[model samples]
Each structure stands twice: as C-alpha cells, then as structure tokens.
Target chain A: MRYSKYFLIIIILLSVFNLYAEKPFKYVETGVNTNSWALIPAGEFHFGQHQHIKNIDYDFEIMITDVTNEQYANYLNEALEKGTIYAKKDTIWGYHPGDPFDAYLHEWEIPAGDYPHMPINEPGLRLNYENGKFSPKAGYENHPMVEVSWFGAKAYADYYGYRLPTELEWEKAARGTGTNDYPWGNTVKRNQANFISSHNLFAKMFGDVVKTTPVGFYNGNNYDGYQTVEGISPYGLYDMAGNVYQWTGDDHPKVHYRYMRGGSYQSYEYNLRVWPRNSAGPEYTSMSLGFRCARDID
Target chain B: MVEWGVKDITVKLLGLDLESVERSGRIIMLYHVIAMIVTSIEVYMITSIVPMRKHQRTNINATITVGWITAMIFGMAFAYFGHNYFYHGLFLVGQSLIFFAGILLAVTLNPWNKHFLVENKEYAHTKNGYDLERIAFFVMTVSMLISAGFGAVTGSFWSNGHETFLAEDLIRQPDKTALQKSIIGYLHIMLTLIAIAITLIVGRWMDFKGKLHKFAMPIMIFGTLVISGGVWSVVWTHMAHTFIYIGSTFVMFAALLLVIYAWGKLIKDRIKEQGLKNPSFGQKFVALFHDPIKFGPFWQMVFMNFTVSGVGIFMAVKLEEIFRVWPAREERITLTGHWHIPAALIATIILMYYIDIAGIKGKLRKWLGWTIIIGSDIAFAAMTIMSMKRLFVTEYYQTPLVNWTMLATDFGLGIILILLAGVLGWRLIDLFRSDNRWSKESASPELELERTAVLTKQGRDVIKKEMEI
Candidate 1:
C-alpha cells in the first residue's frame, strides 16, 4: 500500500508539469524567413571593444532585426498546428529535455519537464492568445518580440534549426574586427539607439509607458523629418548593440541562466557598448528584453 | 484641475475660499481624457500622417492591443477608486502601452526609411520648407513620457495628498508641495505639447513659409526641451525659481517665433498686394482673420500659448506666495480661468479644423468658423480682464462691473460650446442619414478624385504661367 501511494504521488507531480508533453522528436529544419541570414566570415575579430580578441572557426549567419511579435505569433500558430507545443493555463509550453544537470550547487534537474515557451499574458505583452489562437497586437507586429522567456526565444530558434549565438559570437558580430564603442562607430548620439532618455520618438510618443522601438529602427533613414542612423555591425548584422537584448546560448556548468547581449530600450548608452553584458534565468521575461537567432553557415 | 468628486456640484457651486489650483484632479482628468479621447485621436493622426507599411501597421495594432486591456483596467480603477493608488497603478500601465504605440507610430511615419524622399529629389528642401511636422510629432511623444513621469511620481509618492476626494480642497494643503509641484510640471509640459501639435497642423494647412519657418523649428525644439528638463527638475526641487525663469523665457521665445512666422506671412501678403492691380486689402485682411481654405490671422492668435504657459509656470512657482495673499473670491476664479482660457483655445482649433474638412457650404462654414474664432477670443479676453482684477486695488476688483464680466464670459463660452455641439451634432446626423449623393464619405472616391484632378490642372497652369513670365 505504501509503495502504491508513493507511485500515485509521483504520477500527480509529473502530470502537473505535463511531463509527457508531445515533442516533435523530429528535426524542424530551416526558419520562417530562410533568406534573411547575413554571413560573418570565419576569422578572428577583436571582440568587446577590443578589450580582448576572440575567434570563430566557422562562418555563421545571423538576422538583421530582432525576432518580432508578428514572427513569434506566426510561429506560435504553426507550432500549435504541428503539435510541437501545447497551450495550458494561458501558457505555450513544449517538451525540451536538453540540459544535463549534475547536482552542482543551486542546480536543478528533471527527467522530462514541460518547459513553458511563453506565458500568453504579461504586462506590456505584444502578443495575445485568445480563442485558441495567438496573434500579434495590431501596430506592434514589427516591434521586437518581448515579454518572452529565454526558453521561448530558444524554442523559436530550435524550430528553425537556428541557435542563439553564444556571447563571444555576438561580440564578434557587433564589434566586427574593430574596437568601436557602438555597433555603428566609436561615438554615439542621443538617437543612435533606442536607449532610455534618448528622446527618440518612441520615448516621446509613449511617455514613460512604452519604451521599445521597432527592429532595425536605427537603420539610416529619416522617419518623417527625424533622421536616424543605422546601427549595423560590419558583418552586415543590424541591431547588434541596441533595440532589445538578444538572448545568447551560454549555459554555464550548473546555472539555468542564458546570456543576453545588446542593451535594450530601457538601457543607457553605456549599456549599449559592444563589450557590456546582462543575464537572466532562462524562464525570465520582460517588456524590455527580446532575442534574435543565428545559424552556422551552410 | 477642479475635482468633480462631489456628485452634483455645478460650476455655480465653486467654493469661495479654495486656495490653490487643484492638480490631482487634473491628473485624473487627463488620465481620463487620454484613454477616452487622445489615444484614438493620436492613432488617427499617426495613420493620417505616416505612410506606413502593412507590417508596421500590424505592429502598431499590437501596441494598441495591450492598450485596450490597460484602458479597461483603468476604467474600473478610476470609476471605483478615483482617490486611491489603484487608479494610479493602472494609469501607469496604460501610459506605457499608449506611449509605446505613439513611438512606434512616429518611427513608421518617418519617410527616410521608405526612401521616398531620396527617390523624389523634390521631396526635400522644398521652396516652402522641410516637412518638419513629423519631428514635432516625435517631440510631442517625448513630452507625453515626461509629463506622465511627473504625474506618476506625484500620484505614487504622495498618494496621501490625493486621498482627499472632496471637491473643495482646490488642493490647497501646504503639506502636498511635492504632489502639487510635480503635477503642475506635468500639466505645463503637456500643454506645451498641445500647442506644438496645433502649430504644426496650422502651419501645414496655411503653407507657412520663409526663413522664419526654419528658425521656428530649431528654436521651438530647444525651447520645448529646456522647458521639459527645467520643469521636471523643479519638481525635484532643484533651484525651482531659476529653472522656472529659464524655462519660461525659452518657451515664450519659442511662442514668439511662431507669432513672428505668422506675422511674416501677413507682411509678405501686404507687400505682394502693393504690386497688385486692385490691391484687395479689405478682402485679404478679412481672409487673414478667418479663412478656412487658406492662411489666417488666427495663427497670430495662437500666441495665447505663451500666456497660458506663463500662467502655468507662475502658478507653480508662486503657489506659496499666492497662497499667502489670502486670495479673495474673484482671484480664485482668475486661477480657474487660467486653465479655462487654454481649454477654450484647443476646442476652438478643433472646430476650425472640422469646418475645414466637413465640406459644409462655404458661407455656412465661414459663419461657424468665425463664430468660434471671434467668440473664443472674446471669452478669453474677458477672462484675461477678470484675472487682472487681482492686480487692481482690492476694492476695484469687487466692483459690480468685474463680477458681471466674469459671469458674462463664463456663460458666453458655455453658450458658444453648446452652439458648436448642436451644429456639429446635427451635421453628423445629417451626414449619417444622408443619401450617398451628398455625404463626404460617399464622395471620397470618384468625386474627390475629380476634384483633385481639377486642382492639379489649375496648379500646373499657374506654374506654366509663372514659367512664361
């Protein structure tokens, strides 16, 4: 009787996390936008504003803009259709038993936990899930996909056979081979990137309520009469230093956190420097945070 | 800013002994106005002004999507808990969602990314001036953030100050200095932004031109920023008087630039008239005063921005001293009228623009437009005169003439607004109920297209004649 009760308890806990969430268990090849990749040559690049040197042995492809709400919305619908993900309690979750835990200090493990890709509801959330459908809010489809957890960003990358660039690769892309302070150049202006108090139109229009600007918003163009300069890296990657912090794949030995590079709309100019870094646990999300993905050159 | 929490207190019931201008009420009211009115209007402005891509519009829609929830929560909190932190918390959320939409709207409207300007060499450096309206709209967005920041701070940190929901406080409690100052600053910045938006709209409609236009933008932008920074700093009690003066001077200077630009247009017309065969001075002068289809002297009248902003600054800076004066009844209304004047101005402008776009018969349109313009000016002038009662010897302020003048203007403005509403309402009904033959919406396609074609031909003929000359 005692053994049977223990077994029942185990089953109940497993059901809570949806441990048996159906996984595609098959490779989901390519991405929604297959031709958006900008190639970075395989070579050494002075990383972190030339504070150090780093090298990548393989050429890589990265996107020009942060993954947007519209893209994420599209992905969520497709993922639901493919049964690679499931919606429960207002969250989109999937089966991901990728990490190996070794009982290190503060380390956690699971045989198979239903990892949440994203909660459908959060403050400043740009994507809405209603009536079994996920849709990007109107007028915000191009804004960076935010309020998404690191696992969510990773899930998106995985579905497309892309990987979040490690921090070193990110640094390489932003600074290129130079020691520049910003992605565009050594010097920065108030409107160079969408940082706090930059008084960019987004800052002005939304008051303190809204903060994020659209992806690739820094590309050289005069929005109306307001002139904006492009913030592309030498590798043809855009938004390498600002817009939103792009999550990078940098799992430590035991920690559940993933690294995010590039200062966000809420960050200051200094935070936007090519060398700076910030981090959060994989399940963490925010209105001021988002991610882009990269793939090894094929 | 007057609190309307007292269920049935009409304008006639204004307490005689209210001390300072109530500010939390203004915050509440502004929060109310933004959710109900400003957001939709701004969306219209963004859609009308910005040539956006389908993707950008979709993204903007998402920002607005969040705003709907934010606004719903706000409506509940404000309706049930107007005097509590719950209302404020929801306001902050709505502020974020709405403001985000605005920023996104601004970026999309900007044409540089579209390469539209570069592709058409004539797009930039036009003979009239650069299309600087987008820059103004963007700056206005910043002001939205700055003002809301002040309001949120006041609402959050000094929650106790706004706890008193009685309409009678006029918020005169000395202990609420932080609250009053912060909200006062908030009101000023937003008012300045409103003026900028109006100026941009009118300037474009009037084809305001010359080197004066160039000077106006840079100077106004600087003035606006300086004022925003200074007013915000004053809220933090940073050399409050110094910033007040500097901010006031720069803003006034900016308003003066707008005024000078308007007058310059007037002068240019007069000079050209000197060379005309008939020199129709009387007609030109009348048109300048209230021309719905062309340049008007109302641009000059728009200088009321300076007066109101100065009043906003003076009231904030001298609140302590003003309170010490143990103000009389008439003085209280003057303070009330300080806000009332600008409120009237913005409404008048809205009506004029409606007249311009409503496609009403020209004579009827002119009468309606002129009534608002001249009526608003008269009401403002009367209010300004009554406010001057505080400067006169106390006995003179109590004269029957002064009392009657205040009553007259207040009633006059009410009647004018009522008249406007009646006409506008009937017109709207007529429009909705009319057959496809007369409604503007019905005429939007082929009729509007034919009108545009005729105008384009006339324009081309004028250009051709100028070339011949």
Candidate 2:
C-alpha cells in the first residue's frame, strides 16, 4: 500500500509538470475558421522615432493577414441578420452617381441570391456587388477586404472578441527588435509589396484589373513572378508593407483622425516605409483601406 | 541649378511630363527659328512703313536690324551648343537670347513714340502727358532689363532651386531652401515689382488720351492684380489665404466692371460715328479666297488666341488630374471656361465679319455689342458661383482634398478665369465696333488717303494704288 501511494504521488507530480510545460506561443485559429493568428510572446519592444524611442510590453495574438472580404461579408451578414448592424448607401468622394466614367464609387452590401459565396479554401473575396448585395468578382475571393471604415473595422474586431492593434504593437510585429526601414528590411521593391508598381504591372498583364491582390498571395517570395523572400515581416505577418492599409488603435480625438499603418496597393514606395506615419478621418473609407485584429493573451 | 522637384513642378504646371521635356526642348529650338523670321519681318515693316522725318531713320533702322540679326545668330548657336552639351543652363541661355531679341524688337517698335509723333502733334507743345509716358516706358524697360539680368545670372527663371529634375525629391525635402530667398532672387523680385509699377504708371498715361484709350486703365489694373495675387501666393505663402482669397478677387471684380464700362463707351462712340466704308460685301466675300497671310493681323490674333486657350485647357486638365481627390464640378466648370474663351474669341471674329457685310449699325450695333459682353459675363459669373460653392461650402477635409496650397491655386484660377472672360468680352465688342475692319478698303476717304501715304512710303505702290481705286 505504501509503494502504490508513492507511485500515485509521482504520477500527480508529472501531470502538474505537463500542465506547466504548455507552449507560450500557441497558434490559434478563428472560430469561423476564416483566419489564422500567431501568439506573440510577451516582450518589450522599442517603438516611435529615434529622438523619442519608447519601450512597450505586450503579449498578444494578432491576425496573420488583414481581414478578407469574404470574412467581412460573413460578419456583415450575420450582424445584419441579428439587427446589430446596418449598411447605408452614401456618395463617396470622387465618385459621381450615374457617371459611367466614375470608377471610384463603391457600394457596401451583403451577399445574397445569385452571388456565389466565397469558397472555404480561398483567402477572402473582394467587395464587388450589384443590387445592394455582396457579390465579389470571380477569382477575387482571396483578395483583402477594402473600402471599410475604421468604425466598421472596430465593429468586426469587437464581434470576433479582438481589437485593432495599437501602433506600437503593429510596428513591433512588422519590424521586430530591429530598426528596419521597411517590414522586409531596408530595401523596398515591386516584389516586396503590392504597391503602385505591382498594380501597374498587373494592369498591363490583365486588362481592367483590380488594384488589390489576394491576401497572402505573396508568400515572402515569388510576388508577381519575381522570386524574393524579403517581404515577410519578423512576426510572419503577410502584407506588412502593402496590400491594404491597416487601421491601428491609435487616435487623436482632438483632430478626429486615426492612425493607419503599413501601406496599400495605391501607396508609393516611400509611403511603404515602416516608420512613415499616415492618418485619416475615422469615418473615411477608401479602396486602399482595411484592417486586422488582435487579442490579449490570457 | 534647378532642383528636380522644381523642374518637375514647372513641367507639371506646363502640362508636360518628364519624358516630353526633350521633345519640348526641340520644339522650343524650332520656335527660336520661327521667332527670328517673324522678328525680321517686323523689323522690315516697322522701318519701312513708319515715315521717319530725319536722316537718323537710316541709322536707327540699321542698328535695330543688325541688333536683331546678331541676337538671333547667338540664340541659334547657343541652342545648338545646349543640345550637344545636354545642360539645362545652356538651353536657358539660348532661350534668354531669343527673349532678348523680342525685347529689342519691342524697344525698336516704340509704340508710344510713334503714336505721339504720328497721331497727336497738337499736344506736342504741352507735352506733359507725352513726357510722363516716356518716363514710364523708360522705367519699365530698365526694370524689365534688371529683372531679366538677375533672373538669368541666378538661373532663377530656369530652375526654382538646386538643380534636380524630379518633383518627388523636392516634395520629400520640403525644408530645402529655394533660390528665391537669395540676393539675386530678391533682386529679380524687386525689379519685377518695379516693372509692374511702371506699367501701371504707363497705363495711367495712356488713359489720359481721352475716351479712345478707355480700356487701358482697367486692363492694366486687372493684369496687375492677377500677377500680384500670384506673386503673393508663391512668395508670401503665409499671407496667401487672406490677401489672395479676398483682396485680389475684389480688385479683379472692380477691374471687370471698369472693363465692361470702357468697352461699352467705345462701342457706343463707334456706332455714333457710323460704320466702316471699305470691305464691301463682295470684297469681304472675295477676301476669304485670298491667301490667309494677306489678312495678317486677323489670322495672327486667331492663331495666338487659339494657342493660348489650348494651353490653358491642357493646364486645367493636368491640374484636375493632380487634384483628383477634389470634387470634379469646380474643375469641370473651370475647364469649360477655358474651352469657351477660345470659341468665343473665334465666334466674335466671324460675327464681326458678318456685321460688317450686313452693315449692322446704330442701335443694333450697340445692342449687339452689349449682348455679347453681358451674356459672356453672366455665363462666367454662373460658373464662378458654382466653383465658389464647391470650394467653400463643401466639407473638403473628409477626403484627401484638404491641401491648402491646392485650394489656393484653384481659387486663383477661378478669379483669373473671370478676369479673362471680361477681357475677351471687351475685345469681342471692340472687334465688332472698330473702324479698322479686316478689309481696309471700307475705311473713310481721309483714313484711306493716310493709309495710301504710308503704303507709298513703304514702297508698296501696288497696294497704295489698290487703296486709291
């Protein structure tokens, strides 16, 4: 009876040790299985300008890519059904209604009849629709969602039990412990981002092309047929330099504007620099705008 | 040396891309040749047609012709050298030479002196107005020379700052000092201001010439206000908002009123004096079949206005593209005015010809002139109102169109368009009412005799006899 008791105690100790041995940096997938997240280990990182460097600490899980159109559409539809959200048709700047030449107008709507749902295996869809429905263009299911306001992004994050990453957090994820000029490093090129250059080439290759590329279409190498793995950020975040500008948690309430980080397909090379600051009105929406979400680690 | 950004901005403002710079340079070289030919003709006509009372005429003519020829040769040589050297400074030197040649031609033409000597001998003894005008002209010439000299030496006219051709670089480096802050730059600015002041004085002197020169003061004032406003925006960036926005616009509106009144008076006077006698319906009809070169001034004005308006339209379109984030309505209306200016100018030319053939005179002439002027002004006013509404009433900060500099530029363009419409409207009225119709044969007998004398002196007996017949 004494030997059996000793064996039981050892087994209990082993069980407790196993519980403590669980990995700190766990990989978490969204409940809807729409996106993957990486758990960033707790650490302090230097942030801000050289003259006013800041050390910030955080342990959080961040989305691997910007929220995709299909994911947003799903969230939007569910919210509408629950009477938690509503879509309003408003005239966007630079877009004239009934003007055939005005290509900037975008209508936010939920997908309905005849509009094919994004495939589960695809990244996400573009927000192209007719008759007030979210009908993404064919083959654009994997593209990053854009034309979403900061409020909409916030709502999406809240619905998913996440929040927009702070500027420091986003920068830490992009540049890590180093002071790189870009997410990919000091140099920026066409393959390193889906910027104006890439869009130009895409337009040449395919007539009447959409500006944004599929999320994670560039896998740290071979972007638009060019072989290079210099685009990936330190934390394995795809499109840390370009694709669509990501909304950050930072805001200047006095100015009524919020900070946006990374860059978009419409961004110039200089704008894609990691340290360059950009902002817009919180209510503003543009074709080159989007967001990702983050959550605190327990 | 010009910074790349300044060069790019200049090119953009001129509605050209960097890729087209070399082509434009080539075209400018060609323009030098054409200018030389035209200058030569002008020199010949001025020396030959204007009867010189003294033996000094030969010396004056010889000096002018030689000076022009020398300037042209130097310009051509410098242009060729610049093309080979691929230096923008060298290209500027060539352009400056051509510009100097034009200045020399203007000096030789001496319109004020000619008008004083040939048209008004009665006031010669009093000579106060004549003396003042001469002094003003002298000051204007000297100031213009000083401005040009300073501009050339510092390369301020050619480049905005340190030579670079990329606009992106300049925008990225906003703290970099512009050449305009330097000594030579300041001198250029000062001289330009002096020239403008002298031009105003000259306009006042011209206005003293009774009701015939009524358009002088308003046109000059309008031009001065527009130029000063532009200078204020560019040089005194801090004051652009208030000074240019309100002051310049108010002055411009007043100038427009003056222009309309002056033109109305001139047209009324012409109508009271009766219509031109030459260029009978048959003559006008046959003149259309003649070589366009024979019509000279008419074709010249048409071509010049067309070229200028075409350039304006091009600039407006490019500016619209640059400010693509802004609402399109204001830009569209501005562009429409640019297009309409040339069309209206052309239509006025045709209408004047028809009025002459139809012998439309008296109350009809006055009414027609007023209708054209007032109609155009009303249209332009409507456009201005629309542009103003878009500029001031809308919430521009919500989009990417919140640039203060661009807003200022648009405002300036809108006011300038209004001023332009006013000027063109006056010119249209003047064209229809003027005694100097396209066919000089319709002129009064006394005027015809004076023209024949001038033609005979120029050794054009064939034309003089044609005039007598």
Candidate 3:
C-alpha cells in the first residue's frame, strides 16, 4: 500500500517527461519572427461585438507575434547589466509606480514597489538566468515568454521605449475596420489558432503536449499531411486571440486592476473576443499571461 | 492553391478535374480490398468444396503471391500518408502478379478444360453443364484487357502532355478530351466488368445447376460487348449515358435471373425439410420463402446482388434527380452509394470465412453471420439516406432532438462494426501467437485440403518436408 504513492509519482514523472520530449512543430513558433512589426494606421472601427465605433487619429506599430523567450531573455540580460532591473532569491524583481485607487465599493489600491516579474525557479519558466546571463531554454527559444506578470511585461516594453498597447489600440490592431469576431473573419475552425483544445497540428501529432505553441504557428501550410489555416490578424499581427493573454496598458479608473486582452491558450474561446476584456492586479502572473509591445509613430 | 489531397500531377496534365481524381481515387482501394481480402479468401475456401484437384502447386504459388501482394498493398496504404504513391511505382508491377496466381488456378483446377474430382465424385464447375460462368469469365478477361490497353493510352497522354503543354512554361489549359476518354473507358470497363463477373460467378459457388443460368449468359455477353466497344463512343456519338444505361440494364437483367435461380433452389430445400410437417401458419409462411436468419454467405451475396443492383442504385439516382439532395450537387459526397453496400458487408463475409477456417462451431459461428450481415446492410442504408439530406435538413439535424436520434443510430452502427473487428481480432490472436493448436493438426488429405486453404506456402512446405522425413 505504501508503494502505491511511489507508483503514482513514477506515473506522473513519466507523463511530464513525455510532455517535454515531444519537440514542438516548426510552425508553432518562428521564435525569430517576434521582431517583425505591423502598423495599425489611424481609423475608426466597430469597437466590440456591440458595434461601438471608436476612432484613433494617430498610427502605431506593434509586434506581429508575442514577446518570445529569446526576446525577453535578451531584455533581461540587458536590464540586469544596466542596473535597470535586479534579481531576488528566486524571482527577477522590477519597480513600478503604484496603481491609483478611487476606493469605490470593492476597489483596493495597488501600491506597487518592488514586484516579482517572473519566478525563475519554477519548472514551467522557459527562460533561465545563470552565470550572470539570461538565456532561453534550448528548443523553447521561440515560444512566448510566459509566467510574466503585468509588471514584468510592462518593464520589458518600457525598457525598449515601447509600451503595452492600450485596450483601444489592441482592439484596433486585432479587429481593424472589419466587423468580425476573430482576428480573421467570422469562423474559427480547429487549429486556426492555439486556444485551448484547438487540436492544432502539434496537438494532433503528439497528444501529450498541451503546452503553448510557438508564436505565429497558424500560417497556412501542409506539413507531411497536417494542414493549418492562415492566422494573421487584419493588420498582419499574429496570435491576436490566442497563445497568451496580452497585458494591455489600461489601468481602469476605479477598477484598480490592469487590463488584458486576447485570451490565453488556457482560456475558453469566448474570452478571445475583442470586447471580452480580462483584468488582474499588476502583480498577478500565470502560465497563460504574456504581452506584446506597441509604440506611437513619429 | 488547390487545398486538399494529392494533386496527382500526372492526372492533372490530362485536363481532367483534379477534385474527381482526389475523391474517386479512394474507390480503387475499396475494389482491391474486396478482391484481395474477402474474395480471395472465399476462393480458397471454395477450392475445398468445389470438384477440383487438391491443387498443391497452385495453392503453394498462390500462398506466396497473395502473401506478397497483401504485404505490398498494406505498405501502400501507409506509404500514401508519407506521400509515396504506387509504392514509388513498384506496387504497380508487384500487384499485377495476381494475374499469375489466377492463371495458375485456371490451369491446375482446369475448370475451363476438364471437370475436377472432389470426394470421388464429379463436381462440375459448370452449372449443371451450363456455360454462362465460362462466358462471364471470358467477358471479364477481355474487358480487363481493354482496361489495360486504355491504361497505356492514359499514360501516353500524360507523357506527351508533360512535354507539349506542361513543360512549355505557359499556363494555358491543355485539351483534356482524349485523356478524359481514355480514363472514362478504363474506369467504365473495370467497374461494369467486375460487377458483371461477381454477379455471374457467385451463383456457381452454391452449386446451383438450373436451366435459368443458361439464359443469363447471352444477355451478359451482349452487355459486356456493348460496354467494351462503347468505351469511347461518347466522343463520337455523344450518347455515353444511353449506352452505359443499356449495358447496365442487360447486366442487371442477367444478375436478376441468377438471383431468382438461387432463391428458387433455397426455398425448395427449406420446403423439403421434414421438420415442417403439419406445421403452424407461421411455419407454412416461412416454408413459402427462406428465412433470412439462416442465411449463409451465398444467400447473403444473392440478397446483396439484388438489393444493390436492383433497388439501391435505382433509389439513390431517383432521389438525386427528383429531390436535389446532397452528394448529387456536392462534389465530395459520392452518389454511387451502392459501393458502400458491398464494401461494408463483404468484410462481414470475411469474418464468417475466418470462423470456417478455424473450425470453431456452435453459437459463435452459428449466429455471427446473420447478426453482422443484417446490422451492417441496414446501417449502411441509413447512412446512405443521411448523406443525401438536404442543406436545410442538415441544418435542422443539428437540433438537439435530431442530434440525439442521430447519436443513437450512430452508436448502434458503431457497435456492429466494432463487434465484427473485435471478433476477427480475437480469432487472429491465436494464429499470430501460434499457440500451435491450429498448427499441429494431423496431416491427412482431408486435413491437407483444409490446411492448404488456410496456411501460407511456407507453412505447407514445412509440413510437407516433415512428412517426407
């Protein structure tokens, strides 16, 4: 009877090993393509499923894919050396100005000081810092950098003179002037994006790996026999509705919480809608939380 | 930019619709599955029942060739997923060796030349001295020859098209007329001829020696002649539909005659049984016609021939024309649902044959045939109807009420097919593991007849070499 616990542990260990052993499909993420940018020009579009029209007079550029592990690792190394960021015992910490609180009904003030950006000690963190340098785990270099809190994501964007897109900017970049529910048009077929239970090619080929796909994975191609649908947004942005929930720049007036958009891979598809806004504290982070950067045009 | 299945560039250069090739290319796999797995196994079993020689050498040669063909074709199925077609063209050469085993059967059994001796009695391959099957075999052979010749024409068209049009670097549509004609001829010959041959030959296996079979020969011969000669008649006369109908009608008429002859004999046998003496009204009604429950492969094949040719295609086509259903307008859903009738049920027949080879009797063998055969035919028929549902009906079918009904129907069918495969696998486990219960049976001439029917050439050789020592 005592051996049963050992047997269970052995079973779990085997399953976890099986999960990582299935190397990701090449299309899952072009880890290198994260540097590419898409320009969303000034326009008024249906802001949500309710057709609330909103306009922007200025243009802005945004990363086409999520911030990949390699991109963030490079940022971490630079920040560490430049003394812009520092590490605690098991987490990389960064400073943030506290969020405002109206103290309305349930609103509590988020007085930020030193906050943990990412917990580097966990198994799920794909970027590792060692030997006075930060490097992405081998073979996971192109996957979206997860375990990133709103603060960590903001710090990365600010380090590069970019900012997390406001909710308006993120929605415009994703939905465009098109009155469609998704980044593409009306329909969302399996494997078109990497949301939960998408049964994308990697999921179909190796059933064990339920982890994140590499950024920009759904560009249409038939590999061997598996097929994928083109998944770029209206303005050429990729993974606008999946991969990870992007931390947006908005700190709501009395909500005291940061805004997130484009639901993560762990989210049910309804949360991926352009108007279906998700929010969390500035310090909150999870395996499904990550962000991209945006900057205004001169 | 065409987004599904292989392009089949060779067929593409011919100016034919690539979608048709992609969709219909799968039908050949069905035909060959029937030819190799079910029909070949049936032929082997029939060799024991027929009035033929032990056919030691013929059987040996067949064991080697068939074993090789099965392996190659099985490899071809997987190779397709890997993008290797026709086993990189080697499968074409390898599969043609079936003709070699067939010719050996013809020569040794000598069913064509002399009567074979079975159990010290003259078991004539002929239907009580009728020559219809012989004529059917001849017709099938000539049609096959025409198919082969036109296959060459198809190849030549592709070769020439590759140089003249495909290689010229301009993307104008080449004339696909001649290539279409060749393909049409090849496919028509194969389908119509194989159907005609199977219809004629299934009767003789039951030893049905009736005068009705004598009349079926001429009608079928005329049908084969019209189809073989009219392969390209559509190009000149533009009456391909009329000619195909005339040919098909004759073929169906011949099959109807054979089916009547068989059922007539089966009813006669049941009526002659003494157990029905002074029977009730139900018994009298049953005596009037044979019970479907007691149906073996022969009876099932006869019923299959009638329903598929006589009723199935007729209704499917009528529904398509009159109702404007799906599969008629849809490119992917095949209108020829009759293929599914044979493709699905013939596998059940293979299970029955497996039971016979294993000599496992009682309830397992007794009820397995009728249960599977009845379930499969009905389920496939339901599937054929559902596939033809209109777009409106299909949309409505997504409703909870309709979806639940469909789920029940699907689960029922799923159980039948799963049961068939499960039973087959259960039997195969013994053979594959070689518990030696099947392998160590004593070698008598009777045992040789049974053993040779089941074992491979290597197994036969091992037993023969052991006996010699």
Chain A vs. true chain A, TM-score per candidate? Answer: 0.83, 0.71, 0.89
Give the Cα lDDT of each candidate: 0.60, 0.47, 0.60
Per-prediction TM-score to the true structure, in the order listed = 0.46, 0.42, 0.48
Provide fnat values for all models in the order shown.
Answer: 0.00, 0.00, 0.00
The TM-score obtained for chain B by all candidates, in the order given, is 0.69, 0.37, 0.65
Candidate 3, superposed: residue stretches over 4 Å from native? A1-298, B1-39, B42-64, B67-78, B81-86, B103-130, B148-176, B184-192, B221-237, B278-281, B284-331, B334-336, B349-361, B391-394, B397-413, B426-469
- What value of lDDT does candidate 3 attain over all alpha carbons? 0.60
Q: Taking the candidates in order, what DockQ does each have?
A: 0.01, 0.03, 0.01
CAPRI tier for the interface of model 3: incorrect
Better TM-score candidate (1, 2): 1
Each model's backbone clash number: 28, 20, 3
After TM-score superposition, the amount by which residue B253's alpha carbon in candidate 3 deviates from its true location, in angstroms, is 2.9
Candidate 1 colliding pairs, count = 28
Tens digits of lDDT, candidate 2, B70-119: 54555454443344333444444444554554465346435344233323
